[model samples]
Target: MTAPASSRLGIYCMLGGMFLISINDMLIKSLSGGYSLHQLVLMRSLVGVFFTLFMLKMEGGFAVLRTGRPGLHLLRALLIVFANTSLYAAIVSMPLATATALYFASPLFVTLLSIPVLGERVGPRRFAAVGIGFAGVLTMMAPQLAGKGDIGWVMILPVMAAAGYACMAVLTRKLGATSRASALAIHLQVAFVIVSLGVWAVAGDGRFAEGTDNESVRFLLRAWVWPETGDLAAIAGLGVMSAVVGYLMTQAYRLSRASTVAPFEYVLLLYSLFWGWSIFGEWPEPTVFIGAAVIIAAGVYVFMREDRVKATRRT
Candidate 1:
């Protein structure tokens, strides 16, 4: 395909993937009241694993899963498990847009980590952008800091989730040279299975006996209840959504320049906002809108700057 055509396809794939992901978050958040995080993860991972296996078979049978970098893939999976768990925790308590906006800091974290991890040098401009981006984070977090909001300490979960996601991104870049995207994707499902089962074994029974009123704690500690038919269908759909999201996002980056497609990811915030409002009657505060704008602007600037640097080096 022509570069322009390929880039357009990539952008569309990204938008589709982000939209599905936003929906997945909404579903997870909606189900948080009735399901333990471990139960949700375990159920979703089972479906994801089956879906991924089917995908792998269609792609090239089992050989496509072969990789020499199992250790790296394992670490990446662990990081993602952490990221997903924390994100779900945040989602249970915080408005979707607010949680998503805080998680938007992943790109900034990636930029900062690149210097030390990849030995990339950042110029002053991108450094300034990072500073401004962090300022935006603090702006969204101001209410929590002042002890005036409902979010409280749970707000930090998304930031921690973002950091974990950033680390996974860096590691994925390092492994991209040799690993199949399918392998990487399935490894995450495997990790989710392992982690979820571990959590269920250790805490599920005890927590079920004594449930707390706090949503976040209940989300974490609640035992597996048999989901209602609708909830079951939704949770099952989550697996399918995750598979589609993985395919689209992977194809998106594969089909175009990362810098070209990265900016479009900010659309996730808008999708989150819409879902938050429509489903939960929750809207972000004005301060959140301002903070999100700053974060998105900074992230886009970083991507643009990186593109410029690459262009300059090529010249």
Candidate 2:
């Protein structure tokens, strides 16, 4: 079906949410040097949980927590937790652009996996898009595959995460009106809390290893530093912005189809590129750009094809 006039707004909202999410990832990566991924995930989840609960309460009473598909909700939450945790690991081990590029493969994975999982029809166009997307990935991986840095295996994490994320998106749509978005977000946070705590407990030793005095260490310490009055205001601004962005994102999915909205998520790649350059002075090499371009183009084609199909239906 063609999207409703109201659903059009969700496009912009989702894009904006993707932007905020990218910034969040960039910030975590910028600080990934001194602090472990476990710490970052734990803190982000803690902050997210605080706001998610409030929003859930305001939107609906605690009854929002009750849903027919509680098992599916928990399963979706676990998938997201796993996806994000793997993504964090990939970010710590790989280049920002590369990691983001690989993760962007989720849409293509969704298209491919839908055939089996959802019994969705797939035509030649989608098949081509999925194929080209993988080619783009191979383009990006060529260097790592042949070069000295053999940490190439880390790339699998984001790919796996992307697959899992796509599954979560599929499940989200299946959920229909059985649960509110706010409640779903809360469940995700709950799962994240359990996973993050587990990681911190097991691998927490020496992550914030002492006496390093590196830029990463400085960044972490700066997080704790009591900012001057101006800096304090800026910090407060970001926190509020984070919550606002988070809410808008929740609303986006609540209002639109996952396939329709998920493609615009590629916008995060542009944001990742910006932060990668600004914060780390790490511009991806030419091959990386070539690969990223192909991947993005394939994604765009898929999204466009979906639009065409929807438009034809409207006609």
lDDT of each structure? 0.90, 0.72
For candidate 1, lDDT tens digit of each residue in 1-315?
Answer: 456999999999999999999999999998887889889889988999999998777767778778887778888999999999899988988899999999999999999999987888899999999999999999999887789887788888999999999999999888877777777788889899999989888887745538467787888888777778878889899988888999999999989898989999999999999999999999887898899999999999999999899889999
Candidate 2's residue-wise lDDT over 95-211, tens digit each?
677789888888788777677767677789889888999999888777776764555566577788888998887787677457777887788877877886776565455544455
Displacement of the residue 183 alpha carbon in candidate 2, Å? 1.3
Q: Which candidate achieves the best lDDT against the true structure?
A: 1
TM-score of each: 0.95, 0.80
In angstroms, the error of model 1 at 18 is 0.8
Clashes (candidate 1) = 0
lDDT against true structure, model 2 = 0.72
